[model samples]
Target chain A: MWLIKHIPPMAKALICFTFVLVITSVLIWLLNPVIIPVLVSLALYVCLLPLHDWLTNLGWRRDMSAMAILFLMMFVVLVPGSLILAEFNEQAMLWQSKASIAGQSLNELLGLLSEKLAQWQFHIEVDQLKANILAGLVKDNGSFLSSISSLVMSISSSLLLVPFITFFLLRDFESLRNKSLNSLPNKYFELGWLMYFKVAKQTQGYVRAVLIQQSILAVVAASGFWLAGFDSPVILGLIAGVLGLIPYVGPALGLLPPFYLVLANPEVGFDAMYTAVLVIGVAYLVDNLLVIPLVVARFANLHPLVALLSIIVFGNFFGILGMIAAIPLLAISNIVFYQLLLSFSPKKFTTNVASFH
Target chain B: MAGSPFWQNLFRPDHKQKKHVRDLWLATPIFSGVSANQCQQLVNDMAIRRYENTEAVFKLGDVGIGTGLIISGSVRICMGEKVLAQLEEGDFFGEVALVIEAPRTATAIAAGDTQIVFFLRPQLESLLSRSPRQGAKIMQNLAKVMANRLGSTNTLLEQSHVAD
Candidate 1:
């Protein structure tokens, strides 16, 4: 106890930060299943709260208004989503079969190239290389299929959980906020409440802006692909849009499917590959120049390095979902950290002043 | 009398205590013209604080962000060593911070064990954005409260000048 009492303030702060980080990481891992749904619901609640308030002001009961909003979401978002999912599933199955055939063709092409090089006195193990390539493709495809299935399961569960959670959140928002604020010790109460509002505002803006950006990009990608005469333009565009959730590298990933599709089809020829590149290039340009500058950049407002590092760190731990969640999480943590610094500094300065006196 | 129902009722105030809080908020001039639902909503965002005897609610020159409504005890407002006023239940203080960011002009110390409810500026701003009509009413009410305080201050100044 004496040693602990003798520890420097900076060291104590560091210890506290490390303890909090470790506990948060453990809690996230343990509550992984519920955490995503809860987070998504919170975002939805923020977006829908204004509308819910308006309705309630118009003399509607809280629960009734919440139910009305949920039904509106079902019709406007979920029903169309179900239709799109059905169509995408059909296209995906077809693409999977075609992918296997394409893999074989790639193996043959590699073999032919290796043979041609051998005639020039360069020896290469074409068979071994082709076998290895095929094995890798099969393994990758297996993992991809598993990941997709898991994603679908999680999404379906979220669909059920989101509205249910959002309803309660909207109805009890004021009381819930009060309860949370009241729980803070009196010394921290005012600052804690301010931090909460700041974090909420930042996160709500970020989530809404991201959703708008994604939708615009999806439409742009679909139109570009369709105009370029790509097979399954809708699915390819949707994939591009979804993958575009990752910053920096996302558009590049979105470009790969079209490149592969063009390369694998002999009838389309090499010239079509340039068209595919042109379409994706245009989409990428529009996304970065227009959508990002106007929407995401305005809302997120993080340093590029910080954004990139967050994506790398979060992606390492939580994969694609973490990559998508990284920006908002960083924004929230930034607000909380700065507010804590502000709140603590005055106390520290007072202590120093007293010591000097 | 020890086992009487009235004794039990006196010791344990029922859930009607919450309603009493709502009624108290309703009677405040700052919340004038607000509907019952709006009152309930406002109350939901407020937090009650308890202060021990002689405890400082806030010191003079400290930065503050909201006003405090006295609920169950008295508080003494002071400027340095001089006591300016003693306020009891239903009275509010620190309202100047709600309209502007400024250092507090006076210290507010609880005269006894006291309970106060805080209504923060940010909470009011959020309410404004969510419901403009109700927000307008609150702003108008705040203006009236400030105007009345200004009038009283002018009267006090005039009386002091006459004495001089």
Candidate 2:
């Protein structure tokens, strides 16, 4: 009671805010499963704004532009994505079929191996282990297929959510921002405005640069693959190009499907792998060196590690939506937190803020 | 720069005939991507206007209805006797006239013999509609201008405190 009487209002507010953060973190951790999809939708919104702009500039109205973007997302992202899934499943099934077809052949080899092992006095039962593993896989096939079907259904639903959220975000962003800004408490109003606007500029610059660079990479990769006579060359280029947006992990994730496709084919897989790998490596290098450095980082300047951390921390606290929202969240928070410190802090802090803003 | 090839004559451009095409091409930012020949060709679609030294190009109360760019020499933006800003070669003027069709806000005078390439609002509008990139570039420049103005105002406020 004595402490409550003495504690200042601002200090009390800060304490209250801290408590809110803790509670929010708890809530987000619980709700992450649903929140992650919304986060994915928001990422699509940020990444796709420039495409919408380009189409609108070309004389398509906003609604038409939104429709065009949705269509492109379906064909470029969803269709190819679904095809890759079906294709991978087909290859996996072939491998599964071969496991059975090659089962008799495998038993014979295992018998020869066990004989050689027994000859060497190494009592390892190679034939028995192979038979046991095959039996387990056969028993689990029903559960495995059911799970795969569920995964496919959820992905298709998420794909549909992206365009729905994206169209609204793109259309109503300015009004939403204005309304939110007006809602800030009077004491913090100016700081909030400056922080939000600065963050908006950085986000806009990043989204703009990435969209432009990714589109260029997609066309170039698609064209090169097309020239190389790879089946679904456009598909390869698109997968590689869009995945390049994910920072370090994106490029690695993009490489897998193509590798599978290569391994499946008899004559073309190796060449396709080599070409796809080269294109992706070069595209990755260009994106890191030229596109990101010259364009996004000049304004944003948050390194890949920092960006990744922001995603993880924010995602953990805010759910996956927080992860997707992390970059912009960090941008605005840096501004607001610093600005608050500035009013009473040293002059040097203000200078850094000036240059950054 | 557009009509008068050798601006070496620091006194003034002798021809003083505004090259419409040159000014139009230079007035835009996105046109930076256009080929040199194409820029020249665009200038041919424009009209030129001349301003005399120390004469008012447009005043705070004057009626004005065109958009243009400085082709040669410069203009001083003034409020009464105090010079508020400078517009040098390649600097644009009368932009607000295109944007809002508003009356002049301040007096613009030729600091020296000035020639400008201009297009009536309708012609300028038509040209911009055909080239959205160029138009967006112009809008970007306009944002830059407004930002610079905001910076100057902050500096002025600081200077006022220093004088006190």
Q: Which candidate ranks first by lDDT, i.e. highest? A: 1
| Candidate 2 lDDT over residue span B10-126, tens digit each | 223323343444644555653455556445534544434455678666665343445557777898887668787788777766665554444456667888887665434433443
Predicted candidate 1 versus true structure: per-residue lDDT over B1-164, tens digit per residue: 64332233224332455566678878989888899888887775577777778978886555567888887889998776888899999888888667765556777899987878788887788788878888889889988988888778778778889999
Off by over 4 Å in 2: A1-164, A266-272, A303-337, A343-357, B1-164
Name the weakest run of 10 consecutive residues (lDDT summed) in model 1 chain A: A348-357
Candidate whose DockQ is highest:
1
Pairing residues by index, what is the TM-score of model 2? 0.45
- Every model: iRMSD: 9.4, 19.8
Provide the lowest-lDDT 10-residue window in model 1 chain B: B5-14
Q: What is the lDDT of candidate 1?
A: 0.71
| Each prediction's RMSD to truth | 6.5, 16.6
DockQ for the candidates, in order: 0.17, 0.02
For candidate 2, chain B by itself scores a TM value of 0.64
